[model samples]
Target: MNRKLWAALFLAGLAAPFLIYPVFVMQLLCFALFACAFNLLIGYTGLLSFGHAAFFGGAAYVTGYLVKNAGLTPELGVIVGTLAAGLMGYIFGILTIRRQGIYFAMITLALAQVIYFIALKAPFTGGEDGLQDVPRGMFLGLVDLGHTYHVAGKPLELNLYYFVFIIFCIGFWIIHRAIHSPFGQILKAIRENEPRAISLGYKVERLKLLAFVISASLAGTAGATKSLVFQLASLTDVSWHTSGEVVLMTLLGGLGTVLGPVVGAFTVVALQAELSAFGSWVTVVIGVTFVVCVLSFRRGFVGEVLEKIRTRPPGQND
Candidate 1:
């Protein structure tokens, strides 16, 4: 949260395109945003949702359909997609709020499965093929997102990457602000002891529902942006595997800490990209890594490191 750290991260993002593929970086940003959204729920509110892919993939489909079929602008499509996911989250939260623990998780999983089936059967989703060739329309019907600009005599796809980066920054800021707000403090209290939160006269269910909606909406924003980046919306986005992946990213990064999800997402995505040729073995390796991290560093890679630094004895070497 230091200004210097923020400046350093911004500089790194600005320079990343020159060192790595812009598309890959964009993908990492989208997933990072997604994982952050997931963290807002489970990390802060103690809500373990197992069907978040519903919101993520559902928004992708909605935004893709809007861009490809409705001829909407990319920004507008993303907005509608995000709102749709929020509404879905609201309804799902209403249904699941009365439940607790595993029951709550099961209800979410069940709801997401229902959505997955609908996507599979719906004509607009293209079934197994998904919605393809999604156009990255102009930003606000003015700036062409597809257009590239020359940076140092080399054509750089800075347009869309910058757009995605801006969206990511906004989303990240919103989450950070929320985590520091009084509402977020209440959420933490709820997480630590729901009975105590209730005894304190907080409308625990309402706060949780709001948190759920916000989480889903932001997650949808990530998915919508990702659809634009990939120019496709498919079943892969909606699958249960994706739900598990987000959970893994949150856990690997550090559950309650800001920036943990971002680091986790980058780590997981980079591993997948690097080991893609290994096919299913990549999953095995990731699984092993997750287990090792859990066993040795339960606070997660970043979380554990930060905890150690904070708890270290005075004058001890870091």
Candidate 2:
């Protein structure tokens, strides 16, 4: 929980590509950041958003288009996508803040569906074909991200792993700053007791709006990066299923813990990959995982385990 421990963990991430498959690790990092950003609203602000795919899939399309046909760099594309998501969040938040719980979720889901339809019809997005062959391009006009590495000093293709890794670090740092800031404390207080916080002169609605926009922006960042990673963006990115996937990630990882979503993302993504050969069994497995986690791992995989260690007797380590 100390600064050093967190720093060490980040260092571990930075060094992960050396020991593990870079592409897989990068995917994990991106989803982890997505889950963390989603957690900011649901876990800390106590607002469960059911339409997050709007931000995630929308940004992916935007960035995919920009990178593929517009000749924009990856960084610029990500920024544009994040801004788009923030704008959508602002509009949606303004319309939905008055309603809480199921109403708010419904509003978001409906609005997201609207965006999904737009993506479906948008010419730039390529509709069902998707924006394909997206260039990861050069990083800062120096590092040619279109190339990769090798075990015996050879230039391999698919440098996207490193590109995604860098983006993931930036996203993680931004969320860390937000959650550990003074504003974050007020959001937490609102989560604990909204009426009391409002009575204490805090604008609960505004806080929630800010959190929502922040979450959307960060989710957009992840989505945009993902598009460039896989060299494509399609309807699958913005579908309701993706929204559910992120929710499952946050739930399995431990909502309030920064590292929980990372673990959750890796677990879910890996499971999906490994079970792809099983067809319908994949859905059944994912559903079963969600049910088990909800019924059993209430505090999440990391949250309960970490809490237990913290409460352990002297000289115990976890």
Candidate 3:
């Protein structure tokens, strides 16, 4: 990633609300962060988790519950939610980290199903209707998140959007640092060859567990922020379908690329919003788009572009 590009993105984020719906952009940022966190495990660590919705939706429920019922501030609620997700990730990792390939994926899926059932039946979760009317609350005992700025005759929740943007940036930076750090390298090594990593005397299981915890916590961050944005926490956040959606975002954007998830999330989210008029047909359109992207850019949109640059002939100009 280039510094110029980073700066450009920062500028774009700042201008996004004025140009587009703030709530919609906030939703995109949240999902993008979630996909990035998911990629950390599956794309970089070679760990395929089928139950990430447990962390994402679980955090949403936690944040919504605390903010609405417990009277916690938004930031505090998000922190608690993130911590809860990390704890869940730790427990799940302990149970499934030893398994390989589909075994690991299936175990995660099974565990996630338990979480979904709990969400469905739990009294505090509001069952099927979900935890509604979750207040945004004040930020740090000041800066009311519900405050809307009237800009050019359009109402924009600038405060909340910036809050979400900052959160997204923090989460993205953490992931970027982790991916470039020695720990990230080890995870990649494990991803490439666990046997070799084990032979090298690395505590592979522990490392993987740590990565899982990190991923889950960040996913929680996304969920928490999303709950604040929507003022609700619902079953959709915890469903298996949501988990699959993140997977598609990661793959469609480019599994291992840093910006791929963001691109993929934006594409998927924008498509869903644009195709909403078609109702159920939206899924069909998205499915077709995914197939086309997969077939045309097998490495993913970012992955393929990067590959082309890497494999380009020397001295060739764009």
Task: Tell me the tens digit of each residue's lDDT in model 2 across 169-271.
Answer: 8888888888899998998899899999999999889889999999999999988888877888888888888888998998898988877888888889999
**Every model's TM-score:** 0.96, 0.93, 0.98
lDDT (Cα atoms) of all candidates against the true structure: 0.94, 0.85, 0.95
Residue ranges of candidate 3 with Cα displaced over 4 Å:
313-318
Residue-level lDDT tens digits of model 3 in 1-318? 599999999999999999999999999999999999999998999998999999999999999999999899999999999999999999999999999989999999999999999999988999989999999999999989999989878899999999999999999999999999999999999999999999999999999999999999999999998999999999999999999999999999998899999999999999999999999999999999999988888999999999988988798677
RMSD of 2: 2.8
How does model 3 score by TM-score?
A: 0.98
Candidate 1, residue 53: lDDT: 95
Model number with the top TM-score = 3
Q: Sort by lDDT, best first.
A: 3, 1, 2
Error of 3 at 149 (Å): 0.9
Error of 2 at 244 (Å): 0.6
Q: Candidate 1, residue 96: CA error in Å?
A: 0.5
